[model samples]
Target: MARVDVRLGRRVRDRRAVPLAISLALGLTVAALPVWATAHPAAARIAATTHPSATEPVGEPGGGVPTADPTDTGPVPTEAPTTTAPPPEATPPAGTTEPAPTTTAPQEPAPTTAAPTTGAPVPSPSVPPVRPSAPAPSPPAPPAGVHVTTDDVTLTAAYWNAPSTVATLRVTVTNTGATPARIRLAYTLPAGLTDAGTGGCAGAGGGEHRCGEWTSAPGARFSTLLRVRVSGDAWRRMPLSGSVRVTATAPGAPGPATDDEGFAVLFPPGPPVPGITLDAEEVSFDIGGGSSGLAVRLGNSGRVDAEGRIEVVLPAGVTVPAPPPGCAPAGTDRTRCSLGTVAAGRTAELRLPVSATPEAQLRAPLSGAVLGQLDPRGGRARQLRMSFRITAAAALATPMVSPPAPTGSQGVLAAGTPSVGDGRGGSARRTAILLIAVSTLLVVFALALATISLRRRLAVPSAGPPASPKP
Candidate 1:
């Protein structure tokens, strides 16, 4: 009997154990379904293997037990009410003790339909800050050392003569720096002067008359020669002056360097055509109180006519009467003659009468000078001189007379009678002798007649006179 009972209890325990193992296997498969679906493409097949349809009853063909189905998803429902009965308790097999059961909380299931969307919000991608770039700088300028100057500057004269003359103006440009430079040279001509087309210069600038441009190397020099000429009546009123200017700079320099120089002009005197030549004869004077005469001749020796005033200066201790026409007093002891244009090769005469005062001495010299000019505003004048003698008053007053004239029958003066065609002048003398003879005969006849009358008177004597003769 004990054996039969133990066999039956073993059969029951085996049945319960198989059902509980089946339920636990189903739960674990369901829990693993979501992970399997995510890692594989056959998610529907995995769901079918895990949960059973709710409409299907557990242990349909066997004793009361739960089982898995492949189709529907609703909870299984109980059949129509039959009887209200409690479940029966199970008994442990002999020789073994039953273990106490443990209570466990239910766990939430993982989603199998859709993926979760609300994980930690993804942070925006990190980025760094930005900044702006700067522009490049410019290069620096060149250094300074250049010069401009002249050559033989002392040769630049301040004054000139004649109507025109030639002059040299030499300009030199020097570079006293390490780098090359450029220079501009120029000059200004005074009125009535021109630049004689003779220079080593490049052509003039566009708007500047005498300026030019050039380029030079380091420590190099350049030169230009200018020939200047004078013209017109420039020397008549005043002289003309010219000037030069030089400007220097580097290739890209900002400002310029400059220098200046100047020159002047003048004129010389003219030639003689307009010259005068004078001549005079020697003169003599009585020492104390007497008069004398002088004659002077003037010749125009120049090619051009002589005009302006001609003067004659006299010494002291001499007296002069009224001067000839066209002559007047010109300062002390001087006489001036107004000569209007005396033609070339022509001659003119001046007659002057002079006297010596009581203070005059014998052998005293009488001197005279002739000063003449052509144009009062132009050329230099000419001068000439003559000398004579003075004599004592006791000398014969023999008047200095000119030669006798021809027979004009004006006045008969014996001392000035000129020799005629023949020598016949005795008739006037014979007539004077005849008158003297007649007067002598009259005196003799009168004396003889008086003698005859006396003889007659004696022959007829008186009566008483004859006797008295004896006594």
Candidate 2:
């Protein structure tokens, strides 16, 4: 009976083994399902703690949903990574710095397992520590010295010093500079000097045109007017009180002592109470063809006779014909036409023809003015000024020298004579005076005193002797 029972138990065990084998295989298949699904995004997670061996099966069929390929490019599930980075760059010199090197590569980090490789280089941060030191400063300047001073002025002239003639202002300057310096002396024509500043006395006469002399210096030049405001110290002693503008530079020098010597200036004196007037405001004429004549007419136009020179500035192409025989040119600009002297309330003409010189006649503007007098010493100048232009009247026809006209007597006529009795009357009067003088002296006996006075001093001049005004 025991033998039969053992056989039966073996048969039963064999039958149970079939179900167990199937269940074991099923478990492995279920485990593999999770592993495959985990590889895909669309699956339930398997516990990471589960051992790989646990999923191994003794036996089972080999299938579930098909597994995805390993090389698929779909996004993978992952945690945000840990990384090391460089710091921010420091500010650099604006417009002044060079660019960094570009081809260089970042170096590989040092290896924990081994020494770092030389494949990539690490760029050092561009931060500069303490900036370079600053630059140095500049030095100081020098100092100034003490100032010098000027002196008072005096004047001397023909009109003022001459016996019969009117005054001719001669300005004299007395300066006080230890070092040589110029003393600028100015003379303002007392407002009512003349109607025309430069008339007879203003111009030339008796071989002396420019005749004013300074106190000491003889032939000194006049400076141009300076329009700058006078310094406070200088303004205190202005001649005419108000503000005066002049063109003259008084140079200064530094010295211990003041100089009391300066220059003297000779110029036409100012007009009388009112002023001097011209025959016309300006003298202008045109020279075209034929006879072109320029007459500078004058009128004492005031109370006294005006003495001054008239100037006509012609274009370079034109000139004045030389005077015919008899009349000699009085002054500068030889071509200058002349009126020996124009009397008060009288008229004069200076004829300069357009054909004065043989040249082309052109239509052009004459740009120049007439300055009656040329003395602008220190203060403002009372210059008789005028400007004008001439338009050509006709075309040139012929060029020839024309003969000058003849003149008549200069003074009044006698009762019997038509123009003038030859000046024999003066000689007759002098002879009568000599006869009377001899008769009176013969009776009075004063002739001896006269002879003695003449013999006493014939050479040395008196203390107040006049200084002649000629070079």
Candidate 3:
């Protein structure tokens, strides 16, 4: 009975084990179907994503392909900058950096660099910052050696020869400036004087007259010193001077007509001896300093052409030209001015300039003597000395004089002719001059005489009215 019961149990166990095995197998198979389903779906999705559709592209293994998504750009949408700034310090290598050859600013994306303007801001294309550079410095000033200065000038004169026949003048100049300058000296002689030498100075053709009575010597012209009165080519030291013009720059600017010229005080009249004479024998000028010229007129009181010489004495601080360049002197004194012959019946005139410290004080009187060489005798030289006060500024002109009538010892005058001629006599013209001179003198003398007479008249008492007419 035990064996049989055991067999029945075994059969039941076997039945249960078979069914369980079968059920387990079926469940494993069902789970395996899910894995296969998941694989197939995943494969289909990967294929779809691999190739981009109209809306999107697939993700690649290494890099994602661009997608044409409505929300995203085909690639990535990029935004450009509104403006770019240049590097504050853009120092390129010395050789590599070039000065912007063109004045125009580099053609920026936008084009507008027209600037007289300063403190401007410029925009540039996007670029990396450059290193800052140092600015260039300015050049230096001139060295201490170059300079310019005035030439201290000295002048001396003398009158010599019969009847003051010759006038001699000498001048010297000294340098005071730094730097060796190629010096030149020039000056125009006062009118009425011809040139004394040649090759040394410039010349003007004023010495000769048109009446054909005067002849200009070969060297006649304006005065100037072509080169310094130096011995050799070497530069002479400053403070050196000779009978020459002390020069600086020329008169005018550098050009074709430019010349080495200077100004001087002369017998300021042009084409001199335009037939003139003083109303009287002499006129006095009491001129001070700072005067540029003196004016005067003369009337023709006689019949023949007349001529005369003039002399001037400068007060302290005043100056008279030394032997001026291109001037031929009639006498040794540089101040002596000569006017050619004036017709006997005509009067002549002139304006004279006096040199002085721009502002000098003139005290001593200015005396002028007009004498006609009426004869070879000693008394024939007529001289009139007058007094004048030099004014700070020049005044009106001097009145002209005509020749006086025939008078004084009669004989040929300086012109080497008869003392008196037909029509109104040259002597008459002289007389008129003499009368004016004498009258002027007499006026002064009369004043003194009158003062004395008045003093005496006042001092002498009446004799009690002659005792009342003797009652």
Candidate 4:
């Protein structure tokens, strides 16, 4: 009985060993299933080759050893495991085949073990702190000056004799300085040329036109137009050829003075032999009795009668007397003495009386010109200009003394009084006249008395005194 009992115990122990080994193997396979399911294709391939019987050890709960399915299908068997493991989860549906998962190789971490063999360590690129830089220096400024220029001139001619021709000029002035500058502009015309007007410039005329004291801002420009007239007979003979100069001057400028010049040439129609001559026999006059006399003659050398005016020019403070025959006051210091129908080859005489005002300067010189035109179509006669000297006596400094009446006894006194002719004042004039008359009469009486006395002494005493002296 003891031997039979030992054989049966050995067979039972062998049966129990098979179940325990399968339980441990199933626990390990369940634990490794998720890793194999989630691994790369290479890893899957390795797991497939290394553990082909991985799931075969698991069995059903009723206690039969589970068989491996050729195609992966069905659920995992529920069995009590000998070791701890996660639950088996299904990866695919009942009918579909699950594709193998793919993954890239794990990149090795940046080598922390060794230094680089070829080059030094490439430091992580870092940006430097932003800092401001200084600014560059500025350039210097230019010098200061005034700039000037002119435009081309336009000239026109007319057949009229009064003003025969006209000329126009335009000027431009510029300020190139940083600050405001003052400028003066001047225009000079040739002889026989006169300024008619300026478009925008205010100026004075004295053979030239001058506009002054104009202020201009920096980079500012000014433009002006000037017009002139030519009326003299000389223009008929000679073509008008001259330059109109525009000058810009600044007293203390940083640059040179500027000159802008333009030239002009013009011609006008000529007239017939209209000979108009102007002459003055006496050119100079001494101021006497607050007045002076000018003897002027106008001769017509042409064959036709001349019907123009005798234009006379005089200085300021001198004027023609009232009621001057055939003479009319044209302007200040100017007179138009009309020559009514002067016959051919005849001469006309005129005595122009010019009186000086209190403002007249002593020893100053003034000029007078006599101009005449015989006919509109004829040429102008020779125009003569004469200079006059302003000479005045001491009485001119005082109030002008009235001359004696022409028809009164004072006329006789004035006619015989030499002192009155000499421009003597009232007080000294009367005394000098009286003293001269009395001394003259006394000397004549004394001479007569002495002659009579000498005659008597010589004749009568010759008879008696001669005989007595002989005895």
Candidate 5:
């Protein structure tokens, strides 16, 4: 009985040992699954590939394993959890035949997480990038070629006559540049002067005279003349002065070029006599011994006919190198000119050549005198004082030349006219008046003495007769 019981205990111990070994093998396989999946990724991919969806759990339906929730906010698995079946010798039933080997498509690589960015996000390909706009272009510059110039700009006004006086303005326009140009000239007369509407110049109002446009070829010149009438009241304002401007223009040319010229009509104060008036225009001379003319004008302002000689006394530091026709030098600084019988309302002009010495001052008051008479009777002579200034040599371009006097009444003294003595005729007339007064006084004293003697003789004769009678 003891032997039999020992044998039965040994059998029971063996059966219990089999179950312990099986539990140990299952624990080992479950722990080693993660390592096998990491090492053999291709073989372990059967769970993800064969499953209907990658998120499905690796267990049978209704098993204790949980189903993945699509709406769950849990952390996503970086790598798909790979699961594989246990080895055939460990988990398959003894009767079940091994499943035929299956084929699977290759798996694509998992997308990687991009690095954290700190700068602005890049624009999408569908939208275009914004670019800076370009700037506007500048205007073109003017051409350098076409140009116009002006020369010989002169303004002439009659110095003698005031009423019915005409002033002529002449200018020469030239295209000095290489290219031809279009030029337009306009004249602006000073105040109190009006356009005469002559010389093909039309009045554009406002004392402005406009000459129609003219085309000038290269190196060619065009001359324009404008005559304006001077009112008598305007002439009364002696030394009336102003400037004339001419503007030139052309196509593709720069701003217009202007030519400005200054002009003046000068006159001096004269004696109260209404028959004749005297005037002297301003003179200019170069500092280095240039010569200019002194224009002396004599006008007959009265309705009566008259004539006389004119004498000019120059200031110190000035000399007359050459005297005008019908004029003679009376002294170093004096010139005597004669004018024939001046008819009513007539005038004459005499231009004397004058030169300035090195000592002559510029812009200084140069005082002098002019002696003459309009009355035929000699005693009516009067002396007119005048003054002027000397300017830069370029102040005046050309000396003024006046129209000649009428025939038989020229500025030259005709034959048979009494000579006008040295300018001291006024003193001589005073001396003759004193002599006549002395002679009249002497005659009156003689008459008074004779009358007294006659009275005394008569009284004495009566007394002598009475004494004889008494004797």
Candidate 6:
């Protein structure tokens, strides 16, 4: 019986040895897993697939174990195998002897793939914010409150005399604004009227005139008299019209203020009387050497025949050097020509050759008048005055005075008399000859004086031989 018990104990020892070998194999594989996973990343993926729940928790304080983030897009991480306690052995019943234990290899679990995570939201690309903008500017405004006014004028039969009559115009400028402003006045004269050179207005050409600036206070008014002449032909148009404009002179001011006026020309109720009108052409001549034709036109607007004498008066240094066949010198600066018995509705004209001297005043007006009678016995005389301008000629040269012609000579110059319209060659020759003759005379006088001085020295005997050597 003692020997049988020993054999049974040996069998029990053999059964325990199998379980110990299995535990040792599992521990060795777990230790080598980290080294194998580092060498082969593909093996790590397979190992992760094999044990999904074996992964450790991460991001927890004081827990060094790493875990897979559910939101991570990278490959799943692998985990090492963990050790566990062995299950307890089962005991047999007392009646039957125990059979020998069978030894078998552990079966590996099938590799499981991790399902796709679908919890955390994916973030969109970052974007920027928006903003706004700004605005524009405006324009300027104008001024207000100024007034201009003028009075009407009338001309009478007395205006149809030798010279034209001047009619006065009254213009008033008033300011209704609260502020004082400087303003200027401008006026335009219509046809058949001209500025009479009497008013304080300056001519701006083209029948326009302008006055000086005046400061006008609120509710204050000022008046100016403008004199305008009624032209000789103004009788044709009985009524005339004109306009006045007032404008502010300040910066950024408004447009102009305007007013209009009219003139009425009246004549007496009677038969049509004899009326004479005169007109002449404007002339431009040189001071020393130019001539222009002076045409005097006499128009007799009468019912019956009329007889008249036309007289021309020129300025100083101007003359009608060669009068026409029917013209004669009336005075030093006047010429008279008869217009013998001009029929009704007939016009007469006389042309005279007018000349100017070197001493003539430049830009002076040549004035004249005409006197007419309806009856040769006795009647009222009618006169008309006319004028024309004389301007300096272009390209002036040296002035030369020509000798006057002999009396009673008709358009005939004296022998060897140089005329004002002669060529430059003759003038140059005359100048050269005069200079040569004057130089020759000066040389002859100098030689005669020298000879006389020498003869006087010899006749004086040298102060009697120096008074015998001063005794």
Q: Tell me, by TM-score, which candidate is best.
A: 5
**Predictions in order: lDDT:** 0.42, 0.28, 0.29, 0.44, 0.46, 0.48
RMSD of 1: 86.1
Give candidate 2's error at residue 303 in angstroms: 2.6
Q: Which stretches of candidate 6 lie over 4 Å from their true place?
A: 1-273, 286-288, 361-379, 394-471
Model 2, stretches more than 4 Å misplaced? 1-274, 279-288, 306-308, 324-334, 356-360, 367-383, 393-471
Give the C-alpha lDDT of model 1.
0.42
Q: Candidate 2 residues 1-471, lDDT tens each?
A: 112234346445645554455455455445444433323221111212121221233122443211111222333212111111112224533433222211111122211111111222343579545455543211110111112111112222333333323322222122211112222122223211211232111222221112111111111212111111112122111111111111111122111111111111112222221333332222223453444444444333443444435554444444455553232444433333334444556555444443422332332222222333221223332234333333333221223533222221222112222111343444443343454444444434334433433443343343353456665
Lowest summed lDDT across 10 adjacent residues in model 2 is found at 140-149
TM-scores for every predicted model: 0.26, 0.21, 0.19, 0.26, 0.31, 0.28
TM-score order of candidates, top first: 5, 6, 4, 1, 2, 3
Clash number for candidate 2: 41
Better of 4 and 5 by TM-score: 5
- Residue pairs clashing in model 4 are 274-378, 274-379, 276-381
Pick out the ten consecutive residues of candidate 5 with the lowest summed lDDT: 77-86
Most lDDT-accurate candidate:
6
TM-score of 1: 0.26
- Put down candidate 6 lDDT per residue, 1-471, tens digits, no spaces: 112234345445544544454444445445444433332233233434433321222124453212222222333213111111112214423333322211111122221111112233333458443233422211111232356555555555466563667887766555544444455556777677788863335666676776544444433444556678877675444323456666543222332333223222232211134465556655557545576667767777766667867777665666888888878998897788887887767778878887876445332222222332333334566665544444444222323544332322322223443323334434544454454455455555555555554564455432222223333
| Model 1 C-alpha lDDT per residue in residues 1-471, reported as the tens digit of each score | 112334346445655554555455455445444433332223233333333332333332443211111121323211111111112214423332221111111121210111112233344578443344533211222322344433221111233334555656565444443344444455666565566654323223331233334444544444455666655344432223345566555433333545554333323222223366555554566544555566667676766666645565555555456777888877766777776766777866776776655444221322333444444234555543322333334232223545422322211122333222232222322332343343334434444544444554465534342233333
Comparing 3 and 6 on TM-score, the stronger one: 6
Write the number of the candidate with greater TM-score, choosing between 1 and 5. 5
> What is the model-wide C-alpha lDDT for candidate 5?
0.46
lDDT tens readout by residue for model 4, 122-237: 44469654456644322211223455444333332343455446655555555544444444455556566677654323334445455423444444454545576665554432
Across 49-124, the per-residue lDDT of candidate 5 in tens digits comes to 4323312333445543111222323332222111111123335333334322111111312221111112345668
